[model samples]
Target: MSLSVMILEKEGGLAQTEFLEPSRKGYCLSCLDAVKTLQETGRFGEAQNELEDALRESENWREMAVACLLLGELFNKWGAASPSYTIAIMEKGAIYANRAVQLWQIARDEKLFEENPEDMDHLSSALYWKALNLASVAGLGGCERWTVLEALQAATEAAEQMSAMEDKKHSASEVKARRDFVEGIIVFCRAKALEGNHVSPTDFSDCYHQDTKDEVNFLRHQCLELFISAQEILSAGKQTMCDQNIKATTMIAVTYRLLGEREKAISWSEKEVQGRLQLHGEWNPRTQLAKRNLSMLKGITDEDEIEEDCCKLFSFESARSIKSEEITWSLDPFKLSSTWRMNCLLKIFLLTGVVKEFQIEEDKLIKFLQKVRKSYHDENPFHNWYHAWSVTHCAFMLMKETAIGKILGMKEKLAVLIACLTHDLSHPGVNSDFLIKSASPIALQFPFSNVLEQMHWDEARSLFEEGRETNFLSHVQEELRAEILEMVHQGILATDMQIHKQIVNSLSNRRDSLADFEEDDMTLLSDKAMTVYDATSPADRLELFKAVVHCADLSGQVMEAPVAYSFGRAVLEEFHQQAQREKMENLQESAFMKNLHE
Candidate 1:
């Protein structure tokens, strides 16, 4: 037997391993089948319940291992959805992964190998994934946790398993090589995970001796040593040093920086930044993070500047004139001081002329709009319906102020205004990041991606499909309705700052693509007129629509000092509440706290 097999047999495999007696396997299999179906449908919360039930009913370790591993993966998916509670969610996944290893061990101890020797392979795979989970994220809570060291031990043993696997009989040349590669990977993973933990903020409040300079320096040296070993092994076969190349290099930079080797740190970190940009492109979060780090190192900073909201209140007689066909709506006369809901709808009416142009049934659409307004939680500090109104107001202003020839078609314009109005629909006084990190049911429903925005899109679509009354687009052509629906999705997704660079670049690229139309179309219109009601490329038009909505979403940040600062304070209050929650649990606080403190 190979070393891994021998090790398993020696552990406790002498006993009979058929603990389940084969009769209960059918029920476990059916439960697993149900889990698979639920997972496929993105019903993660439901799938988790089924898997936990199977675990309770499992008669043996093999069945337990399967359940544990699947549960671990689902927990990870759930964590990804928890944008704010990611730390807690990921920790839960790690717990499940670690438990799976224990279950696999129990199977070996029972000598289940006599029935299916292939169980060893499952054990090996489980160990590797467990190590990966340990290394994937930080923010583990509790006072006496052994995080990095524990992860390193798991990874080291996993690598040993791979090394033993290579010597098994009939292990083809390719199989042996693959094992060799993965062994190297596990080693690098150990090194990278160590580096990750090394940088994790610790309680350095004099109460902890390990938080001192000497201890910190020693930890850095240990991390540097591991990265050097990883760099040599993983880079030996290729010039590119594909796996962990940037990670190792970045760690080296971080180590040097910690040691006060400024020049060396800058040199290595610049290389890491370049590699990240090349691999992930300019718009990726990793690329942005690296760029931000580089800028900090270079001592470059950008200060925020907020312009005034420019909303001025007008008397009823004067504001009423804006609705006349003869009078034009100008930003100067509009005020968002009071009557925000009325002004919000009035702005949209002014922009789209839906009632005048399309001749919509007034009571039908107005009542539905009221429902949409009421849906927003009035208690939200910043993301309430009022905030949504402000965003819509900004979008309307952008459409009107920009040259008509440069504006999007009527349908696109309407979609942007509508999107801004409902972008925060059903906002629970919490951000997407918060919901995602908490692994709330909503996050599970949208699992592993775009947690909040996807839910918002779902809400918006739901309202649209509520009935012809709320279907606001029922009067529009079928093709236009579909376009409007898609625009809503794109517009909402574009507001995600994680991909802000991509959205900006996409819009900037379109400026050039549509420039010819802008000039040619402008010549066909009057000097004072603006807007190109028709566009050549519908796909390109959506990009512009997204840009408009994104700008409006960020409008609060650009408002005049009083308004902008007020909104900033509102956001900060929400974050303070989140921080309070973290402190109560002794969990790692939001990174935004550091920014706020700074």
Candidate 2:
């Protein structure tokens, strides 16, 4: 036995040796046959119910354990069939597996294993499923209460049993493959934790990275070797080993991508796409996603192409016809594309007199806007450049149509507008919850709260750093510049949905408190409302500005029905993609996200 195996058995208080035989009569034969028939016919839900019913009805400990193990396997199949094998589903599998282990322990206490040595075979299978399910949900940071170390221990126990069995069902090579795959997952999870970029294995987002950090690259190289080894071993096993082999193949491709070996990554990805198509068919979501990945790899292009197009497409002249009448809250960002979006944004700034009042150089302003637009991930369905433009335009509409414009100084207005523009810089197409649960490097650095919001603020700070030419605030007076920067930070942080209700409640409370004034005073204040607003405390003004930007960030639902519907669909598509990744990576799906579909 390996050191890990020996240590696990000792720590778990399990026996060092056991004798077992494959059941010639296969325990609970009739019940299993019915479940298998349902599974084979693709009625996995029905199969799951049947096994669950069997578990409750069985009197004998051995029979109950067998039923529990079958139920665990059926849940696995059910989840995989849905193509959304979430952490919740994996937890259910782990529950059944744990029950099986407990049932077998009862059998061991009653000396049933001695009467029927085949009972040990069922115990070994239960151990294996328990380990695999725990590992799936454990992730790098530990999900619920399951940890990778626990999975490692369970796998070691299972390997010990398989090794000592007199009539093992799995061949020696297949057993080794299983062990290697589990070890590979541990290493892969570590690499993911270190690397910080948590894009899925099949996600080709930002595929042209110059290099990964040395530490992450080293771990990935180790993972690649183990996955390759497991794949080779599983290749010699029965067709039942095909799914495991495909998993290995996917990891190999992902590791190669992380290492910046595009040729190898593409080659392995092609094979994975083919395997997915064969196993799941063309219409299956996983298969469709695989095909999309393959297409992205084959279609990799020069990153400069977008920059060059932006330079050629945008100018002040492009915004000549963009008037207040044409551009309102009803503006559809989906129809505008990059060129018109950039132009419309410039026109809004011009209309608000932000450019002239701040004495911003036109060339510097264009360069700054171009860089800001490039910072957004065009690949993201919702939080991309178009979303940024839409948010900024909504803020502009509020300023023009409401009293918000008269209430703020020029600096505050400019800061809030800039905040809307860069709020989602370099989004990885996933949310803060994902980062925290996956133990991503970003989460480790930010820790506990406002994970994505803090990261976005950091990126925005980099773009607006004092001395850079792209920093449009460079020529502004030092005292005024500091004020704008502080407000920008507050504005960006305000966009975090975590604090949305607090902002709304504060704003509403302040509005309601205005009713306390005498009617005569209120009549006098109505004509000079701007005077009353400007005389309010600076802290109150800042809070009000934060509310404005926060509202603009979520302005989609308040737009015209058709435009709102389009934006809603785009939002759902982005959410579905994140939920899909959560499922594929064995992380917990967001409750609100699940509710959206329901």
Candidate 3:
């Protein structure tokens, strides 16, 4: 009986030893360590392989959690290479992250005891990874209210879980650092939710425990604070290393601007500019923004002064007409102003070689001018004619510059001249918005304001077609017709300011590209094209053109201060008359009257 009992005890002891052997546990640990090392070294493929090996060896919830977390991170990194893949990768990442969370819960429930800091760190790391994945998924899912609400809930829960873990007694510093990191992320998620137009905070009422407005404001403040803190930390070391701080400052300024706190926005913007300028120089992008904003702010007050200065710069005077031509239109015996006719003649002479320079054929020029003057006597305004003429004069002066003159072909030069001459030939004496709002017959015929510009081109073409061909087209060829037409069309379209800035920016980039080309290979034609392009560009030329014409259109305004004041007074009276008409008709008050009062 004693021998049988000894045999049973020996066998049971052997079985227990085998089950609890250190070597078997060490092997499992080594597998986990190797997988982590691979992941740390960024050998994602190798890390995946090792993780699979570790999982096969352990088949436990802890190892499974680590593997899923690593897989999610790897995929997330890959997705960042392209925005188009963000949604796909984020979806997959969310799946793995959720899997990691589930596995971690299982491991926690099992209550496996481990003395090493690595075990606790792994759980914290899993939570951090899960939060990041959830946040990414939220970002990629876009602004759908329901979808964002769901994502915000998930991210909030993950953040809370992380915070709770950090509060534990045995939490590692690394774990606490991760908790802090995720706090910023939570703030970012909340800010994104508020800022996005589609995802209203009210959509998540069931999950949202706080007041929507208060929550949004709190999140915005939290985001700003975190950004400021990060910037402070980054810039704490050296004065020379403040790039990150400058960027953060700009972001804060932009946020303030979005929030409608203009004063704070401006203050922060000034700081960014001043800081960068002190660190670098005036040419820096930040400094440029500051200067531009300052200029814009000053412009409101300086516009009248600037307009006066521009008028003095481009002084216009009536030229002596060769013949005292009395032209009659529908509006009585209108003696055509000889000085005005002479000014038009001078413009033609400067712009085209249609007549000899020293031996100017005053007769031909005067005849042409008189005909155009008579044809549009009722339709054209003095300001519109002068504006077109001034722009043409500038274009002519620009053409005389060595760089522009050498490259522009005869055809292109003529197109520019003709474009300048006819640009505002058929102008109506009101702004586009006024015309559109009033449903003026011209505006009704062409629904698009841009088409009004096109009409000018068509009128010019009709004039040429009606056996009124000018000297500029003498060398024109049938083959070059398409190109000329395109140039003219572009030039007319350029007079519209709405799309001017974009076109100018494009041309500027092209000019920069051309600057890199060798001098011998440089084509001034391209440069001339850009010059014409800039001159003809809508907003490009309109703002300047409007000011020029407004002054010239009202040139009678500055004939003397009293004359100018009377003109201004007359304009005010006309506005008051319009307001009275509107009131009687029960129509909305016109913007013209509003401006007059303001």
Candidate 4:
């Protein structure tokens, strides 16, 4: 998707094109050449000023849309160059592209497309550029998840329209290439949204989540193919398709870097840098960005090295000497570092006989625990690894010391404890309300009800899947694996505070039935689900398990006053931060958060 300035001839210069007035043809050609030169030479401001002036002087909607599209392209390049202004600049580009789309839509509605069939191309191109701009904004973060979905929708619509065009004006190969290019960008944007960060692609410090790593890499490979195909198809039409070719090249470089093909990434990046230098000069922001990317690639190494180094930092000591009493809520998990928290969790797992009974390999279990610990972002004051450790520790205590512990089978108990450990996995610190209000990426992908809980359950399930190196349950009996995972899912979802009352009430309704069971009749709490118990139904048992985990999730409230106060304050501070972001974004702030801030 590019500026509608030229129709390529044999030499790739401007040809007789649609939307040009015969009387003003010479003037238009001369002006377009001058503007293209200004753009290529990196005189973006001058070119933009000129285009704005031209826009104001436009005699028709067609000219206006063209001017807006050009401005959007310029802003995209400008945003690429300036890191700090990327969001704002890309947003501005989206606005301009949207305006162009509107103008074209107006023109088409006025029967312009029917009268001049070639105008449909203009409309499709506007939509394509609009999609690209919005995708760029979404990929940069701060925008709502709806914006990303909208970009994808727009791109799809554009591609459909391009494919339906029967006009010979656009080459068949070029049309297909442009459509592929748009699809590649859509895939790339999806990958970035999945990453849940606005950080540069080169910054591998926080990469994909352990579970989503495969899916993200799959998308990367798919996009890389799309980009490579687009670049190859446009190779012969470089002069006419300069913008799209360079964009494909840029994406190819980025995709390779993300795919961990460092040398190929560097190779593609070097080509992009040289291409930009030749086309736009050394001072061009696009050229500068390419140069920076190339330099970063040369300096940095594989991200796996970071993972390896992290593994070296912590060792799992044998848990034979660790006491069960140390897993109680009286112990402050917040006081320990993430590594110590991991070690503590491992010891508890061992002490509880979960590892031994489940036939969990210690090394694989440690690896899984490390990944889970790392999944919790430390930047979140309330929902960090500390919170996960604390909640898990509380669950461990309940499973060992409480009446509910006595009622659960080993599979159910293990499920409840594991669920608690991972109940807040990959939490972004913001509450469900905030995620819903912002329409954040996770919010969009997940159902609105207990969105974060669903995400946690999904991630937890992924961690224990077959063939995963970190899967502690990989060698477990298929039947046992299914039972534990199902319980884990329910336990995790039950931790959603929104349904807290429902879960408690459900458990309350079963209390009479539960009390009637004798110690000998408590075989339902063990592995014999086939044995009919008089007092408890399977549903009642599940509800009890739900309530148990839910209680563990809220155990921070029952902690000693000082520890409880710290937790409360941490959550409040996190709420305040989310509220501030809402205010900055001009979104509706949470009422409680507003009250807290005031």
Candidate 5:
């Protein structure tokens, strides 16, 4: 009897069925039949038990391998239903897959399938399934990093082997199907490598060292190539059983976007969106995700236009002015005459030539300064408007040192100053770390923290949104907007600590080419580079910014001991409130707070 018939018999009646096939005379295909019936009926636990019983009675390597592979697939599906079962399911799957691979090797070595085409196919199928199981386990997070690496290596080898077999003159249709299956496995491994724990090897391994960016870039390219190959193969067939093509295409688009290939990324995304919409008809999860991504891509393409539209969507109201005589600080003693100073500075060294002195718009500058001041937290001490003002002045000072300072001149200085002052305006009173750890909805929406910095540009755009009558950049050409946006995005993303060290290291290594100094004056260039480097490096510049804002946020701390004490108490109270919420939800407290309490 065929396997399908045995499955039907087991489902129809819980009786041991005997097959008349010569090869299966002593084999217990009935055990597989029972497991299949149970699995089809959604009785996973029962199916698992049946498979375990079958394993004990099975002596044939082929039968044992098939049974184990089935068990692994069943466990994988069960684990998807509940995360609590993930570890158990993954462990069992790995164990069975390993066993199947070993059995396949033994069968091949014993020459049991030298002329048996059916048995040879079965052995290869077992090996392919084993690799699939390993890849799936590695894709699930919390597995050891080495396990993922090994799985990826195994999947790649299996895929190459299958592809070679498919190229043979007498290769069967079944061989082609197996080859496609292996390709899918390879793609899964690529995605896992990209999205899984991506920390540097130093964090977990003692023998291996690899540059994180280089590794990510290599793997990302591999995924794209595999995706393209899969697409070509899938297109040749009218229909594919695995649905790997669409999934691989989506991942390729996402990876391209992550790699900053905006144009190609947007193209792939648009294609995926159109294809899915044609297939699914309406707003399913895939369609919605595609739409959202398309919207983001459009925003990136014509940022100024989107910002203008947003401003037209919402209007801002001016605050009511307070009477000078009525203003009092009785409740908060720190609200008195406390001297505020900014602790950080941004020095912009202009390499181009300059011009002449022009009239300074003092009131406009003060407004920009005030905007920066407002970004500071009520308790933060390190950052404030003064620091912004200092940075603006430093940039101007550097500009004055350039030949371009003698040309169109003070207008450029005013522009740079205005940019610096308004850079960090409307601060959210939290660091990037806080945003990431809290899984703030904004972080989820963008998946890139630097995108949040676009908020500043948004605010800047608001001023001219209404018919461009009051728009500051409205007088400027549209061509300049894209260039300015790029500069601003780069500067803001540079502030993030995660990418900071890498950026600095890259700069340091390329100093000779980037410094652009004469041979005799190379020493001067080195010194200048060091200065610029130190000013922007995380250890110095970022720390300075943090300290400045932190001090400004806690400016009240300097007023009186009691006032500082109250501020600290309020912060502690907020932490306690958050901790209570986490406790109620059965979640652990944040690591920082957990450390504090311990």
Candidate 6:
């Protein structure tokens, strides 16, 4: 299935041999190094040489795709460097940008995004640059209509591309913030074009003749609206960059001036000038430019007034805080039977130094758990939030009793814990068999597969992403989290018994391996590592995680008689209902329905 329905959601430098056996990644990195210096200094000519080399003998389509986009961007950057527009450079930039867009389109047509979704981001970047190249044309001449509209369209497509990156590599806010940035830039271009078109004639310019007073009035209003929208997005996107705000202020000043609002123009220009002067200092070139603009607006002959740039970049000391002191975790979910008992389990997980070992923030973990707890279908007799807590509790007890925490490394333990906690999340109070038999749409996506388990994991993943945005696992490194999550995914899926033979065989091998191994004290590994611990292979650890969670999920069968029977009765009741539902709806009854009376 397309992932849309799914809750979708560096190393620098290179050695020589790394290039000899060049992968797409190696080629891309080499190309990146070539252009990396361009951002600082150096001639565009040198950067083009490296880019051409990468493109000349490219074996990887994705690498070629990246090279084309980067080549386009390189030319664009070069074109934008000159104060006066150079027709040759501008035309070359536009041509490359268009080619980049075409190559990306061809890739999509070839199902490259489907074949390897990571290519989507690169394709998106290619689309955005096309818009950027067109937008830089000042929206003038006979091509103005096409240039302006095409730029807007391409930028919107770029934003769509940004939103498509929900593979857990980025937070939702990070994606939205990026989309907002593109929206801001595209809108700013429109506003800039309009403002420029209506400006008073310069010695060699004829733009004023192109616009009548009424046209100018209408265009200025449109410019103001677009500028405001751009400012709001830029302010909210990632607010640390003070430069965005200054850029917006400059636009506001220019637009107001074109509208014949001299006082308002001067007012906004002064803010920009003052901000630039304070931020960059009086001697800075940017500050000098701002001063000249302000001087023209204010009709001043005197020295410029300097103001303090009180604006600051974002810095959070809490991001680096370490919890060295031990915490006493005392919550016993069995004794404390509140439906909200899951909250305590989460807290205990954190306070017991487990989270410290994982480098996950306590508050984010708590909030994430609470979100899952609240999302449960509590109305269900079984397979509800309380049952979720019970399974997790049983898992916790099993881990403690077996000293599994010691035997299975932290990643395995974590995978087992999280898998147990979220295993049955969002259950519909019906078994997967019934859903499939009834021909439900939910089953259609995973026909003959673990539909319910897949759905539960999908829901859990959605909730997990929400928590991630709030920095729940912000303390955890990305690679480590990905590793743990892989195990967790296996553990959750292992709970499904439809493919019992395969799971049993896999677990038995790992179980025997672990059984002969001597158990030791909990030896914590680095929180940042994604590697396997001790002598165990990653396959063994993942298998162990799945085996342990499977045991926890079925632990209710071995509980006290009363507790075990209660669960048995609940399952039977749900089965009986499903049977009756099948009869009423004229559907095939599942195996559980045959034994409902028993």
**Better TM-score candidate (1, 6):** 1
Candidate number of the best TM-score:
2
Candidate 1 lDDT tens digits, 428-501: 76566666565455654555466778777777775554132355565765446767788888888878778889
Report the Cα lDDT for residue 474, model 6.
Answer: 51
Give the clash count for each candidate. Answer: 17, 0, 10, 1, 33, 1
Worst 10 residues of 5 by lDDT: 346-355
Candidate 5 per-residue lDDT, tens place, 529-559, comes to 4443354343443332322222222344443
Residue 165 CA error for candidate 5 (Å)? Answer: 4.7
lDDT of 3 at 538: 44
Candidate 1's displacement at residue 129, Å, is: 33
lDDT string, candidate 2, 1-598, tens digits: 1111112122121121121221444654445654445423434345546656666777767667776776565444433332222356667777887788888877788776773545666776687677666555544334566654554455456545544555456677876776677667656655553343432222323233334445456657776888898888887565422667777888788677656576888899888888877765666545665675564454322453456665656666677677668877667888766677888877887888878888877666776687678778888878888778878988888778767777777887898888999888878888988987765545533544677787787777655543343667767764577688779889989999999999978855555456555544532224344544553578767976898889889988888887688778879988988888888899888866664565
In candidate 4, where is summed lDDT lowest over 10 consecutive residues? 1-10
**Relative to the unseen true structure, what is the C-alpha lDDT of residue 16 in candidate 3, on a scale of 0 to 100?**
24
* Full-model lDDT, candidate 6: 0.56
| Candidate with maximal lDDT | 4
TM-score of each: 0.45, 0.50, 0.33, 0.49, 0.38, 0.45
lDDT of 6 at 265: 82
Best-to-worst ranking by TM-score: 2, 4, 1, 6, 5, 3
Candidate with more favorable, higher TM-score: 4 or 5: 4
Better of 2 and 5 by lDDT: 2
List where candidate 2 sits over 4 angstroms from the true fold: 1-57, 74-89, 105-122, 147-167, 193-217, 236-241, 279-286, 293-338, 342-392, 395-503, 510-550, 553-598
